[model samples]
Target: MASNKSAFVDDKGKPLRIADSAMPKPGADDIVVRNHAVAINTIDPAQADGFLIKQYPTVLGHDLAGEVFDVGSNVKRFKKGDRVIGHARQFLTGQPEDGAFSLYSRVPAGNAAILPDRFEYKQGVVLPLAIDTAACGFYEEGYMQLELPSLDAKPNGRVVVVYGGSSSVGIAAIQLAVNAGYRVIATSSSKNSNLCREAGASEVFDYKAESIAGDIAKAVGDDQFVGLFNAIGIPESFDVVNPIMEKLNGGFLANTKPPGKLPSFIDAKFVLCIGDFGFPVWENFITKALESGKLKCLPEPKVVGKGLDSLQEAFEVRNGEVSAQKVVVEL
Candidate 1:
C-alpha cells in the first residue's frame, strides 16, 4: 500500500497539521492522482472554520493538477502517468482521500479533465474550481442556463455580463460563456481590463468607475441580454450589480456567493458550485479546448510554497489581498 501525507485541520479554526494517511483506493469511475500542485480558494478558509464541513481532522481543497497514479475499473479516460486537472470533491463526499490538500487524492473521473502538456501543473491547477463554479453559474438551468461550451461555438448574438472579470471565476465565466456562443461584457479594475479581454470578453468596464453600471448597460443596449454572472458576490459588489440588473430591466443574477436581499424586480439566487454541474463540461469540452489552445489557464498562478506543509501558507495567501492570480502550493 502506498503511503500518503496530507495537511489536515483537526478542528474548526485550528491550524493545519501534516500527517500520514492511507493511500487512496480508487472506486469505479475514480482515479488517484499524485498531485504536483494545488490551488487555494476563498471558500477554503470558511471550510477550515467548519462551514458546511461535517467532520474534524478532515483534509480540504478543491483544485489539483497532477499525473494519474491509479485508475479504477470503470475509468477509461485516464491511465497511470496521464496528466490531469481535478476538482476535488471532499466538500461533497466528506472523505479524506477525496481532498486535494495532500500528496495524493482520489478524484471522480467526471470532475476531472486531461491537462495538456502545453501547460504546467501550477497553471492548470487554477482551473478546476473556477471552471466548475463558472459552469454552475452559466450552464445550470436555474442560473444563466445559456449553452454548454464547445470547440467551435458560433456566435448566438446574445450577451452576458460578468462582474469582477479578473477574478478566477470571472475569467472562467468569460471564457466559458464566449465558448458557448454568448458575447461577454465584463468588469474589472483598469489594470485587469486586458486580462478580461484576453479571456474573450468583447468589452471590459472598470468596476471602480462611478459610471460602471450605466456603462455596461449602454453596451448591452437592444441586444439579447442573457443575464448577469456575478463572480464577485460580496455585499459591496451588489451595489454595482443591482444597478446593472435594474438598468437591464431585471434579469437573472447568478451569484457565486450567498446573495443578500434584493428588490422584487430582480430574479436572483446564490449559486453553489458543488455537484455534477461540471461533468459535461469536463467530459466534453475541457480537454479538446485545451489541446486546441482555445481554453487557457488564465490569470496565472502564484506559487506560494512547496510540499504539503506549505498548504497552510497557501491558504493564508489566498485569504490575503490576492487579485487576478491564484495562490498555489507546489507539492
Candidate 2:
C-alpha cells in the first residue's frame, strides 16, 4: 500500500489544496489501483461550487484509468500489473467516497474491467463515463425495452436524433445507435461536424441553424424519428426538439434529469447511472467493443498539469474553458 496526497476544497470554496490521506485497503472483492490518469468532467466544477449536491470534503473524480497494484483474495478477474478502468468509488450514491483524483484508488472488483493492450491508460479514461451513460440511458429499468431487430433485415429506416453529438455522451449514443443499424442524425457546431460523422452519424446538422428540426426532417423524411438522446440537457433545447419529436407514435426522450416532469407530447426518462444497474452491463460491453475495434477512443485529453498538486489549476481550466476535449491530470 502507498500513502498519497489528494487535492480537496475546503468549506470556504477557495482553490483546492493538497491534504494527506491514508492508502486505501482492498476488501475481499476489491482491487487497488495506482492511478496513472484521471479525466475531468463538467460536474467537477458544479461540485466545487456546491451547485451539484454531494457530500462535502468528498473526492470528486469518477472516470479513472490505471494499473492494478494489489488485489483481494477473491478477486479473480484482475491481477497485479494489469491496467483497468471503471467506476471510481465502490458504490453509486452519486456522492464520492474516495475518488480517482489522487495517486491511488480502491475500486470494487465487480466494477473494474481490463484495458486492451493496444490502448493507453489516458485513452481508457474516456470510456467509463460515456459508456455507462449510454448503457443506462438506453437499457435502464422502466424505459422502453430494446429488442434487437431481425438479423437479416433492414431497420424499418427509423430516424434517431442526438443533440450535442460532439459531447462525450452524444458521441457514444451515436455510435451505439449506428452500430445497431439505426439511421442517426446529430447536431453539432460546424467545426465538429466531421468528427460527428466519423462517429457514425448518418448526417450532421448545425445546431445553431434556425430550423434544425426541420433540416433533420428534410434529411430523414417526415415522422420517421422514433427516439431522441438529449446529451446537452439544456431546457431550451428540449423546447426546440419537442414539436418535431411529437410526430412519432411513441417516441421517448432520454436525459440526465433527476426524476422530473417533462413537457407535454414528450416522455422524459431520467437516467441515473451507477453500479446498481449491474456494473458489468457496461464494463463488459465496452471492453469487448474496444477489443473488437468497434468503439474508438476520443481525443486524448489535453494535460494541463502533472500530479495531484495540479488539480486546482486543472479544475480552473475545466470551469473556464468551453472546448470539446476533456481535461486530464496525469499522476
Candidate 3:
C-alpha cells in the first residue's frame, strides 16, 4: 500500500496542516490517482471557511492531474500508470481520500480522463473543475440549456456573454460556448482581451469601462441572445451583468456564485458543478478535442510551489488577486 500524506484543514478559519492519510481504496466505479500536480480553485478557500465542509480535519480540493496508481475492477477506461486528469469528488462524497490535495486521490472513473501526452500535468490540471462549472452554466436545466460542445459545431446563431472572460471558468465557458455554436462576447481587462479571443470569444470588452453593459448589449443587437454566464459571480459582477441581461430583455443568467437581486424578467440560477452531466463530455468530447487542439487549458498554469507543504501558501496565493491564471502546486 502507498503511504499517503495530505494537507488537511483541521477546522474553519484554520491554517492547513500536513498529516498522514489513509491509502485510498477505490470503489468499483473509481480509480486512485497518484497526483503529480494539483490545481487550486477559489472554492478551496471557501471550503476552508466551512462552505461545503461538513466535518473538521477533512481534505479539500477538486482538480488534479496524475498517473493512475490503481483502478477498480469495473473501470476499463483507465489502468495503472496511465496519465490522467480528474475532478476529485470530496465535495460530493465527503471523503478525505477523494480530495485532490492528497498524494493519492480516489476519483470517479466518469470524472477522470486520459491526459494527452502532449500536455503537462499543470496545464491539464486546470480544466476539470472549470470544465464542470462552465458546462453546468450552458447545459444544466434551468440555466442556459444550450447544446453540448462538439468537434465540428455549426453556427447556431445565438450569442452568449461571459463576464470575467479571463477567469478559469470564463476561459472554459468561452471555449465550450463557441464549440456549442454560440458566439461568445466576453469582459476582461484590456491586458487579457487577447486571451479571451484566443478562447474563441467573438468580442472582448473591458469590464472597467463605464459603458461595458451597453457595449455588450449593443454587440448582441438583434442576435438571438442565449444568456450570460457570470464567471466572476461576486455581487459586484452583477452590477454589470444585470444591466446587460436587462438590456437583452431578461435572458437567462447562469451564475458561478450566488447572484444578487434581479428584476423578475431575468431568469437566473446558480450553477452546481457537481453532476453526472460532465461524464459524457469527459468520455466523448474532452480527450478528442484536446488531442485535436480544440480544447485548451486556458488562462494557463501558474505553479506556486512544490509538494504538499506548499499547499497552504498556494491557498494564500489563490486568495490574493489573480487573473487569467490557475494556481498549481507540484506534488
The model with the greatest lDDT is 1
TM-score of each: 0.98, 0.87, 0.97
lDDT for each residue of candidate 3 in 1-331, tens digit (9 for 90 to 100): 4799998888888988889999999999999999999999988988988897878789999999999999898999998999999999999888889889999999999998999999999999999999999888887666788888899999888999999999999999999989888999999999999999999999999998989878988999888998889998888887787778877888788988777677898788888778877887888888889998889878789999999999989989999999889999999
Candidates in descending lDDT order: 1, 3, 2
Which segments of model 2 are wrong by more than 4 Å? 51-54, 90-97, 147-159, 220-224, 247-250, 258-261
Candidate 3, residue 116: how far the Cα is off, in Å: 0.7
True lDDT of residue 170, candidate 2: 85
Top-down TM-score ranking: 1, 3, 2
Candidate topping TM-score: 1
lDDT of prediction 3: 0.90
Number of residue pairs clashing in candidate 1, backbone atoms closer than 3 angstroms, sequence gap of 3 or more or interchain: 0
Candidate 1 lDDT by residue in tens digits, 185-225: 99999999999999999999998798987898899988899
Alpha-carbon runs more than 4 Å astray in model 1: none
- Per-residue lDDT, model 3, residue 169, is 93
In model 2, the Cα lDDT at residue 241 comes to 64
Model 3 weakest lDDT span, ten residues long:
137-146
As a whole number from 0 to 100, the lDDT of residue 103 in candidate 2 is 77
Candidate-wise lDDT, in order = 0.91, 0.71, 0.90
